[model samples]
Target: MADLETLKARKGAVRRSEIPSNVLTALNRGEIETVNLVEFLAVDHAKLFRSTRSQLSLDDKSAKLIAATIKKLADVGVMQRLADTGQVFHQVLDGSEDREAVYQQLAAHPSDVLRNWAAYMDAANAKLTFAQRLKRAKPFAIDDNMGVREIAWMCVRVPAADKIVSQIEKLHPFAKHKNYLMRRFAIELSRPCGVWTKHITALKERPEIAQPLLEFCREDETKYVQDSVANWLNDASKTRPDFVETLCDRWLSETNSKHTQRIAHRALRTLRKKADA
Candidate 1:
């Protein structure tokens, strides 16, 4: 084992010029404490440090150790303590099996910490290519756990809108997906008035971005699907009040699905209330 002081100095020196091999060697030699190293990485160069792990060519032994080290951090509530949500999120995501368990825990956690952490993770998707991020996020969209699915939708939302230039057209397939959750994912995430997201000014201007999923979800039986459709229309009602009223009126006239009518009524709640007043 190398001197602890020397290891600490080396860990502190991790920068753009830092070599992953040197860090791996230190960890392999048991010179640096895994807990200490992870803490340092989390506090300092979190995103860069996560990238460095891949560059290190993590073998089975090293990967096991790294994953365990990350779990240890979770065990100690290190993620909750961290000021940087991105650092906390990526560190959790870096784990192997423990990653899923932790995500479940975070999803059920109180809204403040977990929700913010999820938002940060979504923002971090900018680092991945459009296809790469979407591929990784697809599974989560339909995950049984509601919290995990919300995070998945969050991940899909920004990259689709911000990273990919053809946001609306590209998202059309999600509307037609066999899974209702996925169809809901498309509607909820891409809403013009999405909360805790960058409002798509384009939706207010074009409004057509929502067309692909709107009518499809209206015909669906799932309450979850109906809610997303209704919520999206409700959001639009805030900005495009007339458009929502007209659309809902048309849907109510055309569709006998009580579910669809229920959604349309809820979506026009504000307008109806105003008209009555």
Candidate 2:
């Protein structure tokens, strides 16, 4: 458990000529806390730090020193890698104190780094807990369009159905952003037998909000939304025959191609069979 003082002291011992002046000063003045060090290494030197083997054009001594510093920081539980992207991947760690501290230090001030780090720390080891991710996702919903996309992708990656439902609920308010997030959610939900019935019921209650998702399912679109709507209709056909028939008829009458019309036709046939039975 390395604290701020320990990190600062260690950083001070490094030769001034070896390290950058600002970085050295940040250490000597105690300005480089553990959070600051973690974020700096994670963002600035992340590729070098995480590499199993080094490729940088530096002497062995400098590379070893830098690598040693990164290992020490990681060993102290200040930073962690959540997943591997083969070449490189995302790392999540704490930030300095708040937005202001980060803004003054990092190049891209007050950006998605904080939100991403927070979410990653919350769920890094505990793959089952989505509480932290959900809470962080809410704030990002109001700002940062890219944050919304990242959070939406996170939801899809989680294995739990309930977490997916919670993600959809959190992101529903942002459906009007026109950023392809809502459509992405709809596509994920449309997978057959992937999510629980309770999740499907929640989506059904917001047809008005979800209407835009239908457009993604058109024949020439080639989006996941298209097959997703078909899957949703198929699922609804099992129990809500009348609702399925009505929705299918509405979709069929629209001026879309026969490919899309075929989906509606299939739903109608299934509904008719269920009605007769």
lDDT of each: 0.60, 0.42
Clashing pairs in 2: 217-226
lDDT of 2 by residue, 18-80 (tens): 565544444333244323323333333333333412322334554455445544444342223
lDDT digits (tens) for residues 1-277 of candidate 1: 3555655565344453454555545444333423233333333223323433443333556445544544445534433333244444555456555554444443343222243344445446445566666655675677554545665766666556764335565566778889888798888777887765677777765566577679768888889888888888888887888788888888889979899888997888887887899
Poorly placed runs, candidate 1 (over 4 Å)? 1-127, 163-165
Please provide TM-scores, in order, for all candidate models, with all chains considered together.
0.59, 0.37
In model 2, where do residues sit more than 4 Å from their true spots? 1-185, 190-201, 204-212, 215-220, 265-277
RMSD of each: 14.0, 15.0
Error of 1 at 227 (Å): 0.6
